[model samples]
Target: MFTTVRQQGWVDGSAAITGITPYASALECLMHYFREQQTICKKCCHVNYNHEAIQQCKLQKVDFIWVNRDLENFSWFLQLLNDFENEQLTYLETLRANNVTSKRYIDFHFYFTSLKSNNQGMIGYAPFDLAANIYQNVSNRDVLTKMRTKTILGRPQWSLLFAKFKAEHRRTSVFFTGKPVMGEDIKRWCDQYQFMYYHEPYF
Candidate 1:
């Protein structure tokens, strides 16, 4: 039998293990474990729909998986955590600069949940105004498609800006998720900055 690692934030029904075979590989086991945990969290949130609580559960799942030292799949979850934290920081900074209370601002949870459910990639846009507009307006399929198209069109500019941001934040470790093989430039960049490079196989 596959052992289930008990985590602090797990709810009763969400905590139970089922449908996962002992013969599954380590990566498959981790994915199954986290997927079940997410389902449990959603069920637990049915009463009050506490987004923060659900997010906490998700992070706890990542932490539990990380403790197993499964670097391959763990890296992707770590990147998700980093992205969420960085986005929240940007939101707070935007609110502070505008002299607005956080209560008046849109919660990052909404955007994040939408992305997760839709299997959408995070758009690391630095400008809070544009990001907010995209988040607030891209509630439907047509708008989401339009926004994605716009992003694709502006990829060149966004890439340059992201590169600059990485340079400025070189002290912070960057994790790249993909196949084990990395391009020469990326290898060189990480080596030059001594940034921690994590290569997670695409799942």
Candidate 2:
């Protein structure tokens, strides 16, 4: 079972299924459980999700898994908390359309449900809150210093930016960023949160 009592702001369904910020941080947490090597977790960092970084992690026997807790994957959710194993996202996508509805379409309802839930399970909103606070203080800093430049699970998880905003506003506020090349996921997140902001979509 996951924890209840979610923080204010951010979509109700949006939760931090993974305890750490980046995938590396999650892996580091795992390492600390056994090896207790603080430096190993700190030094085992990645830049832009490269092959070398993944290879290094695998050499250490660390499993790279991105656990996003949405309402859509009942089977996978059971696997994550109970089975203690990672589910391949690739397979989830292939099965998403088939089991969701008769017509093919993207399923974001799980994320919506997660955000709306009172008990946020194991997910927390602290990381995004910290980002928003820091962004306001240092919005003019270098791109890499900002929230959006960081990636989660070897991919750009755009939700981090909104998580920051939600921290300050005390409500789930998504930003459009208004970039044409912006991903569908970003657009959907913003739509669900009723957010309206225009920028490069990158920090």
Candidate 3:
């Protein structure tokens, strides 16, 4: 369904950020945006070629997850999460001493009491959502300036898009593995849409 190039891919948010400067720069501000929620907002769950790495944090009863073993992308983000019956078994220890820094971790509280899994993904509070959320929550001069000139990596093509009311769709989760693997070639595996890209993190 793609004219140019549409291939399913995976992102090691942690590893992927190292190359893109703008993304890396914006990431700091994004991190401050939620103390860690920024990755959930900006970094993680990116469209193809612009994907990010992974992370985890403890949030009351809910676990702030980011890493999905490759193959999961072929389906859908919410489906992978909804399929999660237990965090204890589903939790991926990709980051070894991450709890203290992100202040987030995995647990049993799913927080979807009255809501069903399918519809629960689309709720938002608008006006407040803009100020509180860092992902594309562009506003006055300060934030826009930081977005454009933060200088850590490169500039995000968000402010102008936000100004014009346009949106970027999450397409393929593309990322270069950048290294060689034993069994499948990263590029070839990505083309094939295999694990690390579409795997079952849980059962």
TM per candidate comes to: 0.29, 0.20, 0.19
Q: Please provide, for model 2 over 1-203, each residue's C-alpha lDDT reduced to its tens digit, 9 standing for 90 to 100.
A: 10111111122212333322332233334433322211222565411212233233422222122223343433443233222221222223334534531211111111222222223332465565456456656763212222222212122335764564345443332222222444355567666655542222232
**Model 3's TM-score against the true structure:** 0.19
Model 2, C-alpha of 28: deviation from truth (Å): 38
* Model 1 clashing-pair count: 0
Off by over 4 Å in 2: 1-153, 170-181, 197-203
The alpha-carbon lDDT assigned to residue 147 of candidate 2 equals 22
lDDT of 3 at 55: 33
Greater TM-score among 1 and 3 belongs to 1
What would the per-residue lDDT of candidate 3 be over residues 53-161, giving only the tens digit for each residue? 2232111222121222232222333333333322222232222224322322222111212212222243443443344335334542112112211111121122332
lDDT of each: 0.31, 0.31, 0.27
Error of 2 at 137 (Å): 21
* Cα RMSD for candidates in order: 14.7, 19.8, 19.5
Model 2 has a clash total of: 6
What is the full ranking by TM-score, best candidate first?
1, 2, 3
* Clash tally for model 3: 24
Error of 2 at 35 (Å): 49
